[model samples]
Structure formats: C-alpha cells, structure tokens
Target: MSETTTAESAERRVRRRQSRRELIVLAAVEVFREMGLEKATLEAVGERVGLSKASLYYYVRSKEELLGHVVVHVVRAQEEALARVLDAGGPEERLRAFCHSHVRIICTDPVGRVSAQVALSGIRDDVVRRPLHEYMSRLESILRDGVAAGVFRDMDLRIAQHSIIATLNAVPLWFSPEGRLSLDEVAAQVSGLLVDGMLAKR
Candidate 1:
C-alpha cells in the first residue's frame, strides 16, 4: 500500500480503538455509580461492557486509572464549556452561565453524575486537584471581576467560591431526571440562588 493509504488505515484503527476505550469508560462510570467506588471492581466494569476482566486490562491498567480517566473526561468538558462562557460575557453573565452550565453538566450526563457521586481519592492527587483548582480559579476570577464592577458585594472570595461549588456539586446526590424539577429549572434555581446572593443590593 502507498504510504498515504497506510497512514489513513492507521488513523482509522486508532479511531476505532479510541471509540472502544470510550465505551469501556462509559461502562465503568455506570458500574462505579451503581456500586460505590470502594465496591466497584474491574471485573464488574468488564462484565457491564461484556469484556472479560483480563481483556478489560487492555484498555485501563487499574480501577484507579479508570477513575482518573472518567474524572478527567468530565472535568475537561466542564473546562471547555467554562472557557466559552468566560470568553464571551461580562462577569455577571459569565457567573450565571457558569452556574447554569455546571448544573446542566451534572444533571445531563451519567458520567457527570458518577463524577459527583464517586470519591476522587482513588485518582492520583494531582490528577484530581489540578483540574479542580483551575476550575475554582476561573470561578474566583469571575467573582472578583463582579466585585470590581460593583455588580457583586464585597465578600470573602474563598468562601464565596467554595460555597457556590459546594452547592452545585451536591446536585448529583439528590437530583433526579424523574423529579418534579427539570434540568433547566434546577439550573435556574441554582444560578439564581448563588448569583443573586452575590449581586450588590440596589
């Protein structure tokens, strides 16, 4: 085969492999959510995906690594969404969008729900901490911008940031697609509660 054709074939193979890996990760998320992280095993995840335990090892080295992959995938999506909001809007708009996006993320995806439900202790410290810190930093920057713009009241940045995140992170624990509130309703409620609380009283 010509070199170009060979490269195209190799790319197709790589894409197929990545697609398989993503399926494995999705199955792992379901297993992790159904069985708590402590109780979740590679064998259980493999069974969910119809792979033997040994075959599953081809995709992920260990349960911890799988957890890291799941967390990273979820966080990376949030980061990308946050970046778009950050780039286009003023502080107050950005803050509202951020809150709304977060709620949507947690409520809309099984993997995202798994992220909130599962403990991150299984993942390497830096792997878990770095994305969290970066996301929090983005949040703090928006808060600070609002304060500077006199749109938000002066307050402890750390407390405000943590409070907003803590509240949003708790959504997966209680939110239900079958519940009375829809995803957009919950997002609006959450954004209003947190964002309105920060607004400077007229």
Candidate 2:
C-alpha cells in the first residue's frame, strides 16, 4: 500500500483501540462505583465489558491506568463545564453558574457521583491531585476577582473556596432521586444559597 493509505489504515486502528478503551473505562467506572474500588478487580472490570483479563490488557496496561483514564474522563468534563461558566461570566453570574454546575453534576450525573464519592481517592495520586488542585485554583481566582470587583464580600478565599466545594460535595451523600426536592430544585436552592452568601453587602 502507499504510505498515505498505510497511515490512514493505522489511524483507523488507533481510533478503534481508543474507542474500545473508552468503553472499558466506562465499564470500569460502573464497577468501581458499585464495588467501592477496593472490592472491584480487573477480572470484574473485564467481565463487565465482556473481555477476559488478558483481553483487557490489550487496551489498558493495569487497573491503575484504567482508573487514571476514568478520572481524566470524568474530571476533564467537569473542568470544561465549570470553566465555561466561570471564565466568562460576571462575579455573581459565574459563582451562581459554578454552583449550579457543581450541584447538578455531583447529584445527578453517574460518573459525577463517582467523582464526588469515590473516583479520586486510591489511584494515581499525582494524576488525580493535579487536576483537582488546578480546578480549586481556578475557583479561587474567580472568587478573588469577585472580591476585587466589589461583587463579593471581602473574606478569606481559602475558607470560601473550600466551603463552597465541600458543601456541594456533601450533597450526594444524602441527595436522592426520590427525595421531595427534585434535582432542579436542589440545584436552584443550593446554588442560590451559596451565591447569596458570597454577595457583597448592599
């Protein structure tokens, strides 16, 4: 075959491999979410995707590597979603948007629930901590900008940033799909409360 055709064929194979890995990662997410990560195993993850343990190795090198992929998929999505709101909005708007996005994801999305409850704890500490640290930094930047703009009360950003995230992270612990408040209600009320708390004195 010509070089160009050979390259095209190789590209197709890479895409197929990536697609397969993605499916495996998604399956691993479900298994990890259900089994508390420790009880979950490579054999189980493979079973979920109809791959033998050996077959799984064709896509992911190890359980740690697979978990790393899962973290990337989930966190990158969250960072992208929150960044869009915070990067462009005014202080109040961005804070409100950030709260809404955070609550919606953690309480409602499947991988998001995994992210809040169990996704980042045990595997690839550096891989997990760096993205989360950067995300927290972005939050601090927006909050500081708001304080400077007189949109938010002058307060310790360290306290404020952790308070906002930790508060939202607690939601999935008790939030239920069958609860009296719908997901929309929870997002609205909680985000409103968070935003209101940060508003500058009139």
Candidate 3:
C-alpha cells in the first residue's frame, strides 16, 4: 500500500480501538453505579460487555483505571461545558448556566450520572482530586465575580460555593427521570434556589 493509504488504515484501526474502549467504559459505569465502586469487579464489568476477564484488560488496566476513565470523562465534559458558559455571560448568567449544566450532566445524562455516583474514595487521590478541585475552583471564581459585580450579597464565599456544589452533586443520588419534575424543571428550580439566595436585594 502507498504511505498515505497505510496511514489512513492505521488511523482507522486506532479509531476502532478507541470506540471499543468507550463501549467498555460505558458498561463499566453501569456496573459501578449499581454495585458501588468498591464492590464492583472487573469480571462483572467484563461480563456486562461480553468480554472475558482477561480480554477486559486489553481495554483497561484494572477496575480502578476503568473508574478513572469514567470519572475523567464526565469531569472533562463539565469543564468544557463550564468553559463555554464562563465567557458567554456576566456572573449571574454564568452562574445560572453553570447550575443548569450541572443538573443536566448529573441527572439528565445516564453515563454522567453514573460517573457522579461513583465514590471517589475508591479511586486514587490524584485521579480524583485534581479535576474535582478544578471544578470547585471554577465555581468559586463565578461566585467571586458575582460578589465583585455587586450582583451577589456578601457572604462566606467558601460556604456558598461548597453548598451549591454539594447540592448539585447529590442530584444523581435521588433524581429520577420518571419523577414528576422533568430534568429541565429540576435544573431551573435548583438554579433559582441557589442563585436567588445570592442575589443582592435592592
């Protein structure tokens, strides 16, 4: 084959490999969510995806690695989504968008919800802490900006940031698609509750 054709063929192979890995991660997320990260086993994940335990290692080094992929995927998505909203609006608007996005990610999206549900305690600290800290910092920055803009009341910024994050992070634990409130309604309600409280009174 010509060099160009060879490169194209190699690229296709890489894409196919990545697609398979993603499929494995999705199956692993379901198992982790149902069984709890500490209780989940590679064999269970392998069975979910129709791979033998040995075959599963071709895609992931271990159960911890698979969990790492799952969490990182969701975290990266949240980061990207937040990045888009950060520059698009003033602090209030950005905070609203952030709240909505958090709910949508952790409640509306199944994989994202599963990712959120997985306890970070089972994963390595470095694997879990960096992205989480970054996300927390992003939230803090928005709150700081809002306060500086005179749109938000002066309060304990750290407490406000943690409260907002904890509330949204708990969505995957109790939120139900079959519940009376649609995801959009939950998102709006959450945004209102958190954002309205912080608004400076006239």
In terms of lDDT, the best-performing candidate is 1
Model 3 Cα shift for residue 20 (angstroms) = 1.2
**Top-TM-score structure, candidate number:** 2
Supply the TM-score for candidate 3.
0.80
lDDT winner, 1 or 3: 1
Model 3: lDDT to the true structure: 0.81
Tens digits of per-residue lDDT for model 2, 15-64 = 99999988897888899788876788898989999998788889887666
Error of 3 at 85 (Å): 5.4
Q: What Cα-based lDDT does every candidate model obtain?
A: 0.82, 0.78, 0.81
RMSDs, each prediction?
A: 3.0, 2.7, 3.0
Per-residue lDDT tens digits of candidate 1, residues 60-127?
Answer: 87877777677677778788888786778788899999998887887788887776554324444565
Q: Please give the lDDT score for candidate 2.
A: 0.78
- Model 1 gets an lDDT of 0.82
The C-alpha TM-scores of every prediction are: 0.80, 0.83, 0.80
A best-first ranking of the candidates according to their lDDT comes to: 1, 3, 2
